[model samples]
Target: MRVAVVVMETSHHRDTEGRRHIERLAATLNEAGHEVSVFCAQWWGGNASRFEPDEVTYRGVTVEPAETSFCTRLPALLAKYRPDVVHAFPTPSSVLRAANAGAKLARAPLVVEWFGDHEESVSARAIGTANQFVTPSELVQTELWEAGADSDLTTVIPESIDMDLVRDVVPAEEVDVVYAHPLDDSANIESLFLGLAELRQKGWSATVIGDGPERDTYERAAADLRIDDRVDFVGSCDRERRLAIYKGAQVFVQTAWREHFATELLWALACGCIAVVEYQAESSAHELVEHRDRAFRVTTPQEIADSIVASADMDRRTVDESLAEYDHAAVVEQYEALYERLVDEYGLF
Candidate 1:
């Protein structure tokens, strides 16, 4: 199957979770032996119209991130590419409409990926443009439906992880608890700190992974709470290192105020860390642990501290086979199946 991915910008242009998801999906599809091409505003230097960075082909629809030219030129390029399916993003709203025109011109099925971080008004205006919609979580799916996407036309596809790495990486030095996320205001790391502060007498150490503008603020919070010595703020680790940390940790604490999908929490769970998610209205972290064993949903520091202590009694594991359903290969198969079904329905074969 051939897939033409339409986007105004990519992770290279500006690092964002949605862009990262799209880029990873395109690479995964290409790795699965399907032809994949991404049409976006050129981020590479020089005047070349096309660039192949890895397995995926990135075709520059415009020299820079010019919204108007990108919207104007994308249709012809996509039509010429003649893809079986046109996969698009709903960020600027205009881009989806442009992609819709291209999909119609190419007679290909249009699928929109709504990652729940964009404006709802734009998504509401653009939802009807695509033949199908994909979201990273049911929370996002509900948001998509509320934004005028038909529930029948929408599906939830969780983020994928390299399960082989989870299974094979050697565990890092053991720690009692772990937390991972960019240290921003939304990180709410204070919740974890307050919880840990309550257990200052307990023999538990934590490793906080990730870095951002608020790193100093979080570190100071740890100090004010007088738990700085026990918590290690090892910033921005690669995936393999994170997996090793998660594998070695007894508990993974998720206190972020918002998450389209709790990707790091999923990684921690797959690495066999007990999930202790603090409930937040906007975050979908709680969804992953609903009705699951060794997972606790809490609302306060006291509960978080209690959960961490309880995790000590649970069995230790370096990997959980049950989460194999979210392996990269499995999620790519979901995309392939969705594309196949849409192609069949469109009689594009």
Candidate 2:
């Protein structure tokens, strides 16, 4: 299978969760024995039109990350590549429109990876061009529906984690609570801080993992609440360190206001942390806790505080066997199945 992934900006040009997700998917498909080529504005320092770093081949549609120029060149490049499937990112929307033309020219099925980060109006128009749409969560699917996407054409595929590492890594020192997310304006870490502040008289330690523009603001909020001493702001640790902490921690608190899909929360749950998700309209965090044991969904700091206290009575776990379905290989199989189904429908085999 030859897959052509279309994203105007590679992660190297602009690092974002959406870009990272698509790039990771391309690599995973490559490892699964598919011939994957990423079409984007060149991020490498050279005049070469193609760069093969690792197994995936990255074809430069433009010399630089100029949105208009890349969009103009994409259709011709993708038509020339002649992939079995054209997987595209739904951001600028123009790129999706361009990729649609390319998919038609190449006679390939177009699948849009809609991350739900763009404005609803633009996203609706962007999704209209694709044969199928893949969202990381139903929250995004619903958003796209409201944006004018056909429900029949869309599918939800959750992010995957390394369950092997979950089973193998030794736990870090135990703590009562753990919260991890980039401390951006939308982080909502203050909610966790206020929740923790309510239990100041109680004996507990919390670790806040990750860093961003608002890290100091959140740290100061912790100080203002007088819980700074107990809450450690451990900035931006790697996945293994996070998994170790999740394994050691009793509860994982998710208070981010805007998450297309709560990836860190998924990792925490697979590692066996009792999930306490604060409901936010834009976040899909609560979806992860649906009908699941040892998970609480709440909307306030008081409720989060109460849930934290209540989780102590629940049985401790090092790993949840139920989450094995979300392992990396399993999720990749879902992608493969989707690709095969599309190809069969198009009679491209």
Most accurate candidate by lDDT: 1
lDDT of 1 by residue, 43-85 (tens): 8999998999996899999988898889999999988999999
1-349 per-residue lDDT for model 2 (tens digits)? 9999998887897788888899989998898899999999888887898899896899999998787898888888888889999999887778889999999888899999887764324655666788899999999999878879899999999888889999998999999999999989999998998999999989999999999999888888988999999999888999899999999999999999999999999999999999999999999999999989889999999999999999988988889988999998999999999989998897743
Cand. 1 TM to true fold: 0.97
Give the TM-scores of the predictions, in the order they appear: 0.97, 0.95
Query: Which stretches of candidate 1 lie above 4 Å from their native place?
Result: 119-123
CA deviation > 4 Å runs, candidate 2: 119-126
Q: What's the lDDT for residue 293 in model 1?
A: 94
Q: Give candidate 1's whole-model lDDT.
A: 0.92
